[model samples]
Target: MTSSAPAPVAWAILGFCAVALVLRLLWLSGQVRSSERLVTYGLLLGTASGLLRERAVQDGLADLGMLSVGLTRQLSTVVMVLTFAPLCLLAISWSERWPARQAGISGLVWASAYASGIAMLVVGTHARSLELYIDRAEGWQTPVYFAFFSGWCGATGVLMTYTSIKELRAGDLRPIHRLTYLTILVVGAWALEEALSIFVSSVCAATGTGGGFVEFRFRANENNYIYLLAGGAMVAASGVVSELARRLRIDPASRAVRQLTPMWEDLIAACPEIPRPANPDIRMSSRRRVHRMTVEIRDALLVLGRYAEPVPDDMGGHGGEAVQIVRALRRKQSGAMPGQYLRLQASAPGRDVLDEARALSKITKHWNDARKCPEAIPSLDGDRAG
Candidate 1:
C-alpha cells in the first residue's frame, strides 16, 4: 500500500465489507449456540479487519505526517489475516457431530493456518524499504509470504464448502440452511481465485517468465480482478447471511400463550397470587413472557382443580386434551397430592401443552363471555371457589 489511493474497486469492496460486518453482528444476536455461531463471529471480526486494511490503502495513510510512515499500512495488513485465522478454525469445526477424531483434525489444521498467517505477516514486516510493490519476477518473500496466507484461505474454503454441501442434503432443510450454503459456495469461488492468483504469480516470479496477465488499471502487476471478484462474493454472502438470520429467527411469542392470554388474565384476576413471575429477569422476549405466564397458569389451574365441583361427563376419559387437563386440575383440587399431579403431568409431555392451553382457553372464553353478560348464564359466584 502507498500514499496514493487504492483502485475504485477496492473502495467498493470495502463498502460491501462494512455491510457484511453489520449483518454478521445482527446474526450473532440470535440464540443459536453452536459452531456456526463461532463462524459468524469470526466472519464479523475478519470483515471489520478487511475494512481496516482497505481504509489504510484507500486513504493513503502511509503518507500521513503525524503517523510513522508505513506503520498503519503494515499493522492493518497484518490484522487482516490475524482476524481471519480464527474463522478457519470455526469453519472446519462446523460439522454436526464433532467426535474426538474430527476435533483433533480441526485443531491441527487450525493451528497450521493460524501459525502460517502470523509467519506471513512477520516475514512481510521485515522486508527491505517496506515498499508494497513486488512484481512476479522481483522478490522471493512476496510470493512465499502470500503462499502462507493463501494456503489458510484455501483450506478454510474447502472445509466450508464441504460442510455446506452436507447441510444442503440434510432432512427437512430450511431456508436459512439453503442461503447459508449459497454463501459458502460464493466464498469458495473467491478462495479459488486467491489460490489461482498465488499459483500463477509465484510461477512467474520463480521462472522469470513475465507475460502480460489480466492486471488492473490502478495496481499494475497485481491481480486486481481476483480481489474484485472475491470482494463481490463476500458482499453477496453477507446479504445471504442477513436473509438467513432473518428467516431463522425464533419468535418468542408462542401460539399457546396467545390463545391462553384472555383466559390467563381472567384466571389471574380472580386469584392474583397465581400470576407471580417465575423468574426475576424481566428482560426476556415476549415469547418467554408467554411461556412463563403459561407455567403460572398451570399452577393456578391445579389449585382451581381442587375446587372443581365434580368430573363432568363430557370431560371424563380422553374426551379432549383441554378437558383432560381440566379433569386433571379437578383431580388435583379434589385432594390428589403433588406427586400424583406430577405423575399425570409428566405423561403429557411438553409438546401437548399448547393443545391443553387451547382447550382451557375455550373454557375461559365461555366463562368470560358469561361474566360479560349477566343474563348469559347462571350465577358465577363459585367460579374461583378453589
Candidate 2:
C-alpha cells in the first residue's frame, strides 16, 4: 500500500533519525574500539535501514524503480538482522570477562544464527507485499518464515535486556553509560513485545483465526518500527551531549593541573618525604590527576606546617595563607627552627575535589607573588621578641 502523502509522525521520525544519525557519525569519527562505537554502529545501521521500511520511502523507491515494495520490505528485514550483529558483539564484549578465544566462539555462533535467519527469510518468503502475506498467505512456509524472524528478534531482545540489567546492577556506572544501558533496556523490552505480537499474528493466520486482528497486528508492527527507530536516534543524540559534558569537565581540570604544577613542585621539594609516586600512570584522566595533585599538595602543606608562624590578623584569607606558605618553604629551606604550626585553610571552601583544585589554583597565583618577596612579611617570632 502506498500513500500520496506520508503520515506526519513518519516525517517526524525520519527527521529525528536523520539528526541522530549525523550526531552518531560525528561521535564515531573520534571513537576507537569502544562500546560507544559499537552502539553507534548499531544505531547507524538500524536507522539507515529502517528508513527503507517507511511507506513514503518505499513508495519513492518504487516510483524510481530502484526497489519494489516487496524488495524494500525484504531489505529492511535483512538490514535489521545485520544491525543486531554489532549489538550482540557489544553485549558479549561487556557481559563476559571471557578470553578472546571464547568470545570469538560466541560471536561465531551468533553470526551463524543471523546468517541462517536471513537465508531462511529470503528463500522461504515470496517476493510479495509482506503485509498481505502475513494477512492472507496460506501455507506452512508463511508461518515458518515468521517464526524464524520472530525467534531471532526474541533472542536478541532477551540478550540485550539481560546484559543491560547485569551492567546496571554492577553499580557505579558513569552517567552516560547508565543512560545508554537504560535506553538499551527500553529497546529490548519493546523488541520482546514486538516479537511476541508477530509470532501470535503468524500463528493466528496459519490457524485461520486471524479475523480482524491481522490488520491491527500489521499496523502495530509499523508503529513498533517507528518507536524503535526514534528511540535509537534519541539515544545517539544523548551520547553526543554526554561527550560534550565530559569534555567540559576534563578541559577545566586539565587547565587547573597546568596552573597548579609550579606550586606542586615547590611543595614537593620542601617535603621530600611526602610520598610522590615515582612513576605516575600516564593514562590517568585529567580529573583524577587534579585530585591526586590536590591530595599531595595538602599532604606537603601538613608537613610544612611545622615551620609556619601564625598568620597575622591583617593577612588572613588565601592570599595571606599563600604568603605564609612561601615563608614556611623559605624557613624549611634555610634550616630555621620548627616553630608554630598553623593549620592552612583556603579563602573559599570547596564543595568537592575539583572545586578544591580550583581553590588551590587561585592560591598558586598569589603564591607566585609571595615567593618573590617573602622577607617583606615579618616573622611572628620577631614580633614576639620586639
TM-scores for the candidates: 0.54, 0.66
How high is the CA lDDT of each candidate model? 0.52, 0.71
Model 1 lDDT, full chain set? 0.52
Candidate 2 Cα outliers beyond 4 Å, as residue runs: 1-9, 96-110, 127-131, 167-183, 242-386
Clashes of each: 6, 0
Candidate 2 residue 180 Cα shift, in angstroms, is: 5.3
Question: Could you give candidate 1's per-residue lDDT for residues 1-386 as a string of tens digits?
Answer: 33223557666665666566566556544645444455555555555544444545435544555444344444444455554565566665565565445657666755765677567656665443545433333457766766765666677677767777777777455576688687777777667666667556655654556545523311531234326435544743654564564455433244445556775765565455564755557666555666676677777766554434333344333223334344444334344433322222222334554544544545554544433432322223434312
lDDT for model 2:
0.71
**Evaluated with TM-score, which candidate comes out highest?**
2
